[model samples]
Target: MSGSLELGHHSSLHQAQDSSKCLDEDGRTKRTGTVWTASAHIITAVIGSGVLSLAWAIAQLGWVAGPIVMLLFAVITYYTSTLLADCYRYGDPITGRRNYDYMATVQSYLAGGIKFKFCGFIQYANLFGVAIGYTIASSISMMAIQKANCYHKQGHNSPCHISGNFYTITYGVMQIFLSQIPDFDEIWWLSIVAAIMSFTYSGIGLGLGIAAVVGKCLQLHTCIANPFLVFTDHFASETENKGLKGSLTGISIGHVTQSQKIWQTLQALGNIAFAYSFAMILIEIQDTIKAPPPSEAEVMKKASLLSTLVTTVFYMFCGCMGYGAFGDDAPGNLLTGFGFYEPYWLLDIANAAIVVHLVGAYQVFCQPLFSFIEKCSAKACPASPFITSEIAIPLGSNRCYKLNLFRLVWRSVFVVTTTVISMLLPFFNDVVGLLGAIAFWPLTVYFPVEMYIEQNRIPTWSIKWLCLQTLSVTCCVVSLSAAVGSIAGIINDLKAYEPFKSSY
Candidate 1:
């Protein structure tokens, strides 16, 4: 994403003009990643804590509408990813070219002074938001694991609780050490491990959901009509009043008024859309592929297709099973919501996977931001050893000392800042909706389609072009509406929580 800024610091205008010469001297060479490794990076980018809430999202839409929305988002995102892959070229289109990062792609094809600047701003801003989201979500998962373990081993009233912020701050400090790795391409092995963790937790969630449904079915002696029916049969007469404690009881589509139904539907749309947001970092991942030119594009496309296939299957299975098991009462996070009893060990394993996966996933998303800051700093301090490595000076020079000091202080500051904000407002689902709404059109849908149409000089009024444009505009409007609604919901939730001084 910071490819354009990389020029500002790493290469001068003279060097930029001679890039073609350098490419000729270097020639085509195998890069770092293979199809499997690249696919792992895509999986790490696509799957996150968002998967945990997809059941609640589907419950809002009910049985018929849920899968449709999830699949639709998957298809839209996959196509946009391919469009991004096509724009990865760094030089001339035909003969001798290299791949460009996200921001550079925008600068190359969509360049108009203000337009390019705005694109860069939103791209990086969305990335920063993602970093915060990962930190916050990971901490919540860790905290939940600790709480559940305590309840399982000791009594419910035992003093085994730890603060969520403590775990978040600790994770942030760990990131400070991990971020010292310096580049994205160097972390393929880490991404692979993270991908495995994602699959493990997702599978565990699916198993728990299935088991819940089977257990319910055995008691009823008949299959439940839907998730709504499951809730009605089990909990309808159990609670005296449907209030805060009873919030988990399933809400039936048949019971809600038209206005309430529409509101919930839109909220579900926002959540599913948020779950599939990985297009922003497509180019950066593409840069890791080993093949050259045309082959690079093909390799990236295959990786994307494979990752989408895997995630879609997992998503459908988990979302459907979760809704079936818990209906409207499903917890925001399936693992955290599990009661600390029969399957306590499984819950612990799942939460541990989540925490570990986020550790790696955070780096995948935040490395771009780190690179951007480093480039900006290098541009400001041309003589600094942090960027230049002080090759001209002795290893023990004072400039190198400043460089080490700058690295520690600067990175620690970013980590601490994100950790503090995450501690302040820990509404994971609503925050995700807002981030998705803000970034969905620009990052996932708009930029790629616009860049494709303009770059290829596709006819403006042709049916194909018109259809793409209409889809883009429709999604932009819907996402903006969803974003506003999410903000309103967040405000209401804050007001509701304020009187009690409840802390996460």
Candidate 2:
């Protein structure tokens, strides 16, 4: 009787400790994330290869529409994001059952039958598309380094065509190893580093753009040598047709056909959309935060505001400067598109930073998919060791790394599939635009508006409801326009382009 009593005492004590340390208020694994780490993840996801295309986007829209469209997207994104953040829990912001991912939040408050399946398909499909886009983008940056070096030696006019195939495979190899990382929370350090890398390249692009404008002014012997004056004078001259600089109306009808100009302008909207997109992954990042006295929803709103502010500021600087430097002729990628060739070494550094940032951003966007696949597999076969087992590899000093076989094999296959698909398409700007157009309205605007209305029991046709619905409709039309323009661009490019055979 005494021995039995002692065993019961020990078991109760163990349970108490486990309950306190291992589980959060929601009875899930305790999350150690904070505002800073969450912000890092947001920055890593938001500022991607999309920023490199912003200059081209501006060049297509001219000085007026480019910055306006970008700012408009920023406001829309931040507003919708706060709505999504509030949906993190079903009934209440804090006490209710947490919707662990975006699809769960949708199913909780909205129709689940078709809507659930559709949400899952769209969310995961968008993530898959991002992986392909990053693959294409990183390879482009890699190729740019080699091409930059070649330009330094050979003349800029010389044919320095280099195949992106090798560089694409190289990136795939790196991702294969990084893919083995088990979960989103474990990759916090990588996200922080990637966030720093993002700032590095963006700042460099802005600096080079300013330098280019100065260099052009000196070459032209303009009356005003100041960079600011040069920009104003250049824009005025271009608008008046005195110089080949950009105009108030964007790429002229002479440079591109009337139809082509229209398509390019619409496509530029999609590029800006892509640059601002992160809503698809926002909830996933929110899942990493620990319980708050202030609640996860409150914390996420702050993070969203901070992230949007930082990204919008950087986007304006880089995009405006790039357009100011090259005018209507701004390249698709500011750095990799050879906007500044003479600063070969600096260009090389910026491109390298881009590759490094994309490597981490790809994992940031894909980890939720990995987790979803693993959860489904485990649910289907809970008893199988392959699905449930974790082999702890000893690292000496009483430490071991837990390795899961399924995570290894599945993530490897996922990376390889995306790599092959990237090689086939390899149309960077068109692909980015399509991915943005496909994901923006549904993931960023539509679902959030619907979910917020349903969650809060807002009466239909009321002022708030009508306003929200109007916003959703406007975004949907924009998405459709962008999709059409991107598709048209792809068709035009395909007239001479071949899969896996073209060189940059």
Candidate 3:
């Protein structure tokens, strides 16, 4: 292995100069290629498969509760992101010693190699799981579209017969095909196309849904009912189950006594995972950000703050409007929920858009995993014969192409295998919770705190500051415990079925 990536060792002036020269020669160091603009990045991060479930989550809560929860989640996300950004801003300049990976290096500093490796493995696993989740979500979106089309054609009032296994297979094939295509530059254009498609289809779908719902209400004016208000009363009157109440029994704030309140809180908290997912993306990007001068870092911080506020507003509006239209029992897929009251054309458009958006989002989500794989390959086999011949000897070859082909192949296999497992299990609510709890939450929440404490050389703290730190750690521990329990529940739920016994 090359000893070039020594942890905590500062780069020499000669090495730094060489790196600067290479960056200048390649034109990669310029701000021109960087897509760090606040608005654009925020929008890209915010718009994902999670949006499909946002309204459904809110519907579980009272209508008024959904947007409020989204707003709170956005605020919390922004604050966490800011903390991460601050850490990145103040961090030392060492290659592979920043961002999430930096957490491992930090742990090595504070603890030892064993802890570092363990933390690294967990964080990497979390990211890999997220990639699988995105793949599954995209596939499901496609299946939904297909089912909707089938219903329209047959004039059948029955529920569509498509299953999770079908979607899993379909998504796995699509991802493999997409992954084989070369050229990372093309992803930006693809993302833009997806955004446009999503906006157009969702816009049309929203219009049609509103029109139909309004017309139906006018025709049956006397019987017309507000789903939001109706559901609120129903939920309030309902008794809370021991299991659900037990699940939410302990918390500092927002603990619920009534079923309606509990439902609302659950819905609101469900979306929090999505918000945290987006924040994780931002944290990953921190490594690539050029170390601006102190003044520039301050400017970028301001921009980030503004961008976050804008995102919060957008989420609030979207969540509120969605809950208003669909009320409780909004379809797990937002497009489908709207489609229930919208015209065929609108549903068709929305369906197409969701599929496209999910494709792009999935790609973005997979980047860090790919990067990790690439790094591991570089260290393990710097000049693999197969990769050197097939990839590195090309006319426009870069050293990065020297990455081990075997590693890439293995990574792809791992992704496909896990995705298949996820598919064979359940889809929808359980999968979301399982993915978030088992993978996403630990990576986003627990790892960050550990990394920060490990990496930074903090001055001695006062008694009050020490108490505050302890409190913060306690909160993280509680959140992590809850998240784990939630995931275990989901796993139990999935295990109860034996639809495909012996398939594993």
Candidate 4:
């Protein structure tokens, strides 16, 4: 069982060569993906709607602990991701047959079992949750655009209420067409576009934060949020003494209940965890890299490292600057939270970029799930034309899309379902945290550690083995707490919320 599966490359290679000159060892069309493309995919996945919430997450965590926690997560994710990379090809880190997706990678090294099934369920469920989260996130940004313009026309004090329900439906309609992208390779251009948009908005958020902090550097600010908080023990004296507005510990009892503070801190961990969740898609991205001198694992390690470094830098700038700017009052979404309303055009661009980035990110997370369901359908009904047949739709210049009826109907239904759910329960921060807390340990930690140990033949309870297991167990506890916190948040939100009628 430790040995690699039988090599099936030759027959496919031979057949592929007969029809085309460009072919990989597995007899597929040559993979043109380079380190840049792979990195683009990783960035697009990593720097998603999650980053918008970083400022709020940090608000829950004080300045000292917030960045520290982010660094800890970054280290853990990078190390485990490299392990996942090593497991991408079964039985050999370099030359063995590929595991095309996360489930395949799990099946290869860990073997098919209950845990394997659990991985599939968790992965797909997380993907679906991400879809809903993105819908909620993008709708908020769209509504923010309208609200921002309204504030320009009206005063800053004007409510400028806008319903997110329409925006959610609009995003779902956009996804219905985009979701038809067959696979990761086909969506390379989209990923690149999304990655660029991520940078655009991230830079804007960071700049706005810096501008806010510097613009008020000399001002002796009042405790504008609350009259009582300024003098209360909960609002630490350091807020006035030091020019920032949070305690060494985060928001305290005067600002919120003790229980709420506890839950918010744990929920903040989930938000940080969510920001580093490209692991589920890492193998699929690695599968795209052309046959390598450095090896896909090595290339992925580099990409992982680079992407992690880049993301950490962006996150720190955005989160820290945002916290510095608004202090304890930092909003859930840095751009859409109305922290900065002037130069509404810039705010408009940043929000537009978020919408665009999420469109591609949605497809990125969903493609593997789409592939899984379609494969199952073909297996179940091999003779059904509805499942297998495709209609040729022309795009001119000798280009055409093979549109599948089942894919169309099924993906459309999936989009609509997520859209409706998002409308019903559009608690954005809570949803993001819950999804992250649910997926982080199992998908991001446990499986990778297990697979790496199995593939490397690491002996039971050896020093390295014990250390790795300890890390996994620790992450499990963290995930549990984050989940509880997020669930509590959602319940609290529902106390006053009306489904499909909530407005911003």
Candidate 5:
């Protein structure tokens, strides 16, 4: 038994060593398509569903407040991400584990037992949920484009609808097929091709759509009316009773008032939080990075900086160009149903992009869940059923059948249960808001505070530093309040929109 255990450990080490070699070779060669530079990965991560919704979200915040909020959120996101990265640097000592695993291991080492389990669970939960949500969203986008295309072909003026079940089934089947592909080396090339196609389709479609809208805008006599400048004129009337009048009034009094700007800034900050999933992706892929432990910091730093810059530029361009072109009517996702009527080629590209994006998202979402399940199952039953049965049972015993049956039943039940919940109550934006608010308070702000307090048992602060800490604490308190309020607002919105008759 000891010899078998040793053999298993040796095999695992061999695999890791081989993986490290592959990464080193891939990293060294620019042409070796296996390696993804951090910038590319960041761009791919950030330019997901957020780009589609930014315009609409910003519109809600108003023109002047929107861009400012985006910029502020970018800064806050960079800071928080740096903090997370720093934690990663501090936690792992010469083990090439990714930040997510490092975080889990660190918490386990430092806190132990339930605290470790809970942290690890939350991290996995968030990763799985976000990945699934991204896939679902991308699928929805694809369905929208398909429906739009059908409507256009049929010459129908009505909006199109696609069945959610159809999409889910189709996506699942594709994922299963993709999973069967054997080589990790091949996937990078596919990702690159997909990335290029996605970029081309999205860029051209968005450009043409924007040009059409801008041409229309230019034709109007009101071309001189800057949308940003018109905020004060429109703000008071639009938000008179929407609970923002006082805030608008204060903003009107002072252009650079910190208090007035803080909320808007934080809203942008929340956008950053929404985009922070990209950083999580880096952490997710940390195990695959080939760099030595000592060099991980430099690698991570370069990766984070490059990735952030790429994402920031993409976001800024999309936001600014999108707003500039469509103004108020610009649909959040550049591939809006309304825009399909404008031309055929642009529509086709958008449709193709949505399809590809959805496909990619499904792969990303399923891989992690599948990997986690495999790991858990392997831990529970380390020995192969054939080997275990041969060793433990009498020769020609039929008891092996019972164990196999139990394993099959258990796995089936687990899969079915997870599938049901995911299909029925798949939480997207507003539902996500509720979950995040509940989780974010404890996980992001409170947990960090507790961790810092527990880890650092010394008081080596000067008066100036102490004052700064106090101010920082004050900011966190205010931010927490705002987050809670935002959650409440989302809940109220949901309630207001609920049906008159409930089946329950």
Candidate 6:
């Protein structure tokens, strides 16, 4: 009896060890990312070439309104992202039952029929639009760097002009390969690097702007003799043409009417919302947090707050400084805009950082969409070899061939499609504005707030609920107004361009 009891105790101990090992592996496979890595991912998603536009955005709103609106968006985004983080817990907290992605959360909280379908469609569309925007921005960044290098080496009028399409196609093709990475967790390192790059260029740009301002105050004519300014001055003698249009400065408040100011303010509001937009991938990123995911909500809350604080400070600094430096004539893209011809090396570095950051941001937003499409593809072609289960593939046989072929074909086609669009509509800032206007309220405002109310079972007439409802309605109106304005702006831009002309 003693021997049997001793044997049973040892056997039970071994069983417990095995169970613990299984749990560890399961957790590892489930949530492969940590708090800081996830925070880096959030930062990468939020900050991008969008920051470049904040200066222009602030210009539209003037100094006082810009920072306030941006901070307001920051607060709203933080609260909604926290609501989303909390909803990641499916049933139990400590038990680790969780919804891994945004769609899953939507499916759980929102209704099934039309609501769920619309949610999924909009969510995926927003994410896809974001990826396309990144692709477009990456190409533009590359072109800007190339142009700066050429002008530095040669002259501004050098015949070495590279077509923007060339860079767009190049970056798009590169993304086709990079997008093949199967999981979000696999690219946390990329996000970290991208996040750092965002801060680096932002700091550099702000420093450069402040330096220019200080030099101006000290009447340092040497510092203001930038190639861009020289070009503007030289071209001013000629007829009014596209090349000679100089940057705008000052409030110029007296020049526009009240209606125009309100319209511009609405547009600026939309752009600010866009600058803060990252909700489509919030839950997907949150899912990367390591389990037991009961704490994912808290982790994500902290991460979102950290990212928001950093980005808001950075946005305010860049926007205010850039506006102060350039005044009303701030370029739509602060980096690529006119008057940046000098300091080729610094410009090149900043644009390169943007390119690298956009590459990672593209993947961060696209991975979820890619996963969704792949899943649908597998379901549709159930009998295809590429769609086989692990057990069916056999241990010794190579299963990667069919999978790789599918990835190559699908992702390449997607990249090519975006490349074509970028080439066709080379209006970079206008297109970004349109995308933001269309997607801002739907993804960033309505869905999150509504889902939060439903998930928490808050009464519709309650103060919290009514406040969010009013905000959602307000966002909707603002989004519509901005969309119309953006479309008009794009139309006006197109009138100046002949078909297939190299915008660069």
Q: Give the winner by TM-score.
A: 4
Per-residue CA lDDT of model 2 for 1-504, tens digit only, reads: 999999999999999998889789877889987878778778767877898888899989998888899999999999999999999988867788888778878998896988888889988999999999999999999999999899889867878999988999999999999999888778988888888898899888887776665543543555476665554443333222222356677778888899999998889889999998888778878998889788998888998998889889989988987887778778888998876775588789999999999999899889888989999999999999998899999989998888999888899999999999888888888999999898999999989999999988999999999999999999999999999999999899888888888598
Per-residue lDDT of 79-125 in model 3, one digit per residue for the tens? 55554555543345332233343453335454657666665676667
From the highest lDDT down, the ranking of the candidates is 2, 4, 1, 6, 3, 5
Residue ranges of candidate 4 with Cα displaced over 4 Å: 1-22, 29-37, 181-186, 217-244, 290-292, 393-401
Highest lDDT, which number? Answer: 2
C-alpha lDDT (0 to 100) for residue 163 of candidate 2: 95
Compared with the true structure, model 5 gives a TM-score of: 0.63
Residue ranges of candidate 6 with Cα displaced over 4 Å: 1-12, 15-38, 91-96, 153-162, 185-189, 216-265, 288-295, 386-403
Check candidate 4 and list the clashing pairs.
none
Clashing pairs in 2: none
Instruction: Return the TM-score for each candidate structure.
Output: 0.79, 0.86, 0.70, 0.87, 0.63, 0.82
The parts of candidate 5 lying over 4 Å away from their true place are 1-36, 89-105, 151-156, 159-162, 176-194, 197-209, 216-272, 284-295, 324-332, 337-340, 383-504
Worst 10 residues of 4 by lDDT: 233-242
Runs of candidate 2 with Cα error greater than 4 angstroms are: 1-24, 28-40, 216-245, 287-295, 383-408
- lDDT (10s digit) by residue, model 6, range 24-71: 433544466777877877776677778888777788877667777788
Collision pairs in model 6? 248-328, 248-329, 249-328, 249-329, 250-328
| Error of model 2, residue 97, in angstroms | 2.8
- In order of TM-score, best first, we have 4, 2, 6, 1, 3, 5
Give each model's whole-structure lDDT.
0.73, 0.86, 0.52, 0.85, 0.48, 0.72
Model 1 regions lying over 4 Å from their true place: 1-28, 32-37, 90-96, 153-162, 185-189, 216-250, 253-264, 290-294, 339-341, 384-403, 498-504
